[model samples]
Target: MIHLVQIIQRFVRIPTGILAIMIYTLIVYLIYLAFTKYIPMLIHQTFDMIQSVIDFYEHQPKDADPVLQYIHNYIERNDFFEQLQNGASIALGYLQDIGKMAVAFAMSFILSFFFMIEKQKTILFSRLFLKSEFSWFFQDLYYFADKFVNTFGLVLEAQFIIALLNTLLTTIALAAFGFHQLLSLAIMIFILSLIPVAGVIISCIPLSFIAYSQGGIRDVVYILMTILVVHLIESYVLNPKLMSSKTDLPIFYTFVVLLVSERFFGVWGLIVGIPIFTFFLDVLKVKKIPNHSPREIDIL
Candidate 1:
């Protein structure tokens, strides 16, 4: 471990501007590939899966489940092909939003590059204005901003680790079950798992639906149990261990904050709520308060 650390330190001491540029270029190329290839292929596979489901229902015996019968009747009445076309169109719209995101990423990269190259000048300029009559106010503001940004970054890092683990576990399980489109499903789960408490529930829907389409209730039940076990591990083990030391919030309280924030603020609330709550808790010194004596508690 000491040798490894020394090696890493030696590598870190090397000049990295060219390396950063190469990495950035590679990331841009990968994003382009996702847009031009992977996404379209995923869409095609999804449509194929839908078609397979339709074909399966078409050949089913008269003694099929009432729910499946109703679905077949509805698809027949509405024209499954037309519905598929509409769904595809909607998906294409979502893809356009990805293009917009790519543009934003490019802009951010450029801005960050400029900032990195001129970091000293940027600091000097900020200090010129900040170290003034209202220096105390600006200093306090900067401290708060720094703390908040650090906390937020740490939280995102922890969440990303959780998402990666979840995706890996999900991919292995899906493969064991002989599920098709394992790559796409794993990618989807990883993305969704970036959201807090409700992300698992959202990811389960498509997984369960696909399982049901493939092998009916038995497969769905198996997938559900797998999801339950994984979710339990994530909630009870990974989340507490990763976040507790950083946020100083109990797992139960963190969950409560997530639920309440989502209820009031919608989907984005799930992403930002816990970090914001933790930031406030830190700023307010909530955790630092000592336990009160019985007399003090009674007075309060």
Candidate 2:
């Protein structure tokens, strides 16, 4: 936040607080747009994708390929569409819960904006207590408290950037292949890219299915190759550079954290499990995430 303020200071003269407010307001607006616009579109696209697949299965020619014929027969025999309807209803309820979370996030950003604006005053206010007879107690409390928040924030920011970049690159590859439903697929990619190794594998199943539906086995091979390349770049290039080295746990640990966190915190645990773990590590003074990372510094 301070770095952003400094960058803005060079362009036009403005009070630090006002600039901070402007930046944060822009962030809040983006968050609002994401929840109100992009997320709803993603949800609708998901439903459409499912419905279209069901329609394709139901309407296939009697003399269709053997595999597709078998798949269609299985769906018909199992009443798959009815099962999907039930799942869709449950997913809708989850989306509504997400809407509630958006409200909570907005409230948090608003409160944090006030804190950013009054940061200097808060520091001075704290210094008075820090210099008192109980200085050591207050100092340790304040230091650990601030470090915990920043550690979580750093990990979350890194993950978001990595996901966004992965989505963009993969979407470009799909577009180059003239894939259908690119917008919907891009949104899905972004959501799944939040997970680590397993996300790419899971995303591949749907992507390959869609690719095959569009252009047979040839397209499936092409998309699989694309996914493989993206996965390699994400794992080897993005993770090491963008992610904090401090939280650079092994693949086994990442999966374990995801599994345990998912069981305890539901879906969100997958997204936040790493960040929470990094925070605890910070509390132990185990490792550190640099304050001015190049990735974010280059952004503004």
Candidate 3:
């Protein structure tokens, strides 16, 4: 197994780094397009929802509550449509910034490509710059890098598997619920699922809102329940099994790390916290060894 991994890493190191950069670029581009194209439609949908509520209240009986009546009148008096238009115009400027970001990413890809090709030269240059007093520091850094790569790579593999499964299940559920735009929603969910606990919560809001818009409060309740169940499964079953298969940490430890990291660093902490914790555990040689009798041979 070690030999196979070494061989695979030897062949894939450069390609993997390049591929990672490309994937990041693609994700950024997709996000830019989604924001530029879909956000206006979403805003329009929200406006329609507001308008629908206002219209409903306008046709209500004369005995309607004074508070509700005041709210409805206030909505009618506001220039919501104009405000939405202005918001869309502001959003277009962000799209221009996204274009600049894409260009920067392209330059980064070029640099990474050259770095991959001249990896040996880069290592030589680093060594030449280091003083003899810092030799031990460099050795420790190398050790940390090796552990990080192996541990983090496993975590990524497990996460990819989880994300794919989550996407498939979410797509099926959306289709069953007769939701429109399954493809885009599924893609969004898959990408968000790569984040961690907060990702599931963040995805639920838009999904529930869409359900409410399409099929009322009951549909929203159903969608929320479905998401809750899926998240439970991911948290209790999939994450523990997959992460433990790669690293020795227990499920409880994983959750604790996620919570603490999120408290400190917010969303990005959730994404990287587990792998970072796993790398440290490995570096510290922490393991869970089973306690057994000396005659614990299998009877079968």
Candidate 4:
């Protein structure tokens, strides 16, 4: 058996490895394309909301506005109209950025497909460089690949379901509390949740501010608390219980990975960071990379 393994290893080379990498990259790009379908509409609605805010402030009833002197004063001092215009511009820019990424992702996916097909000969030849004993490695590797893809798809499906649930709950909560533009805000939150850490902070900030402006301090506090509790349950309870039924990570490292990814890679990093980290960690375990402690694997 050991001798057989040795022959297999010798045959492995760059072509096979590159092919594998390209395939994996194509899969990721496809996922990104799927995400893009929803983002543009969400962005359009968000921009519309900004326009509405601007109009609301601009057309304040002149006489009544004087009566509500506090509101008038605050709006004036804040330059709410100008802020609204700027907000609209920023929102539009964000939408365009998403469009650009979507296009790029599509192009990359196409390129990878062609590259894999054209390099078939090269891919076969590259495998010849591997250590002779490792021929069986590819068989073991492909077995794990099949299993990993299945498990990963399930995890993504679960997270999507939970995110949708959160969106529904938040929208209902906002509507029940009489938030005027609940639909737009709810949609934004739904889209943002897929982004991970930065998404959490970004979506929450707008929600909190909307609650403050449209309702009051009490409403804002209530909204914040509700979201906080929901997130806690989602992160601490639902994730471990449902998503990571077999294994889980410590909460501390989850936060650390989130923070590090958010800081370094912005929104995309935040969304994908944990999954990538887990993948590498798993690979380390498989390869028995020296001095690397094996982490308990989790589906994120």
Error of 3 at 184 (Å): 5.2
RMSD of 1: 8.4
lDDT of 1: 0.72
lDDT of 3 by residue, 1-300 (tens): 222323556677745345545555776789789889877766665566556544565576587666556755775688655775787897687568668867997787667556545555665676653445877787677556656656776676678778788888877888898876665677668867886666788888878756755676777888888888888888778888876555456657867888998898665577778777766776787742222211111111
Q: Is candidate 3 or candidate 4 better by TM-score?
A: 4
Give the local distance difference test score of model 2. 0.79
Name the runs in model 1 displaced over 4 angstroms: 1-12, 54-59, 63-103, 120-130, 247-266, 287-300
Better of 1 and 4 by TM-score: 1
Candidate 2 TM-score versus the reference: 0.84
Question: Which candidate leads in TM-score?
Answer: 2
Over 181-244, each residue of candidate 1 has an lDDT whose tens digit, in order, gives 7667877898788877668988889888778778888889999998888899888889887765
The candidate with the higher lDDT, 1 or 2, is 2
User: How large is the C-alpha RMSD of every model relative to the true structure?
Assistant: 8.4, 4.1, 9.8, 10.8
The clash tally of candidate 3 reads 0
* Best first by lDDT, ranked: 2, 1, 3, 4
Per-prediction TM-score, please? 0.73, 0.84, 0.54, 0.56
lDDT of 2 by residue, 56-119 (tens): 7667877778777777778789898789889889888888878888799878877767866887
lDDT of 4 by residue, 144-200 (tens): 664454344444555666678778877888888887656578767787776544456
Candidate 1 has which clashing residue pairs, if any?
none
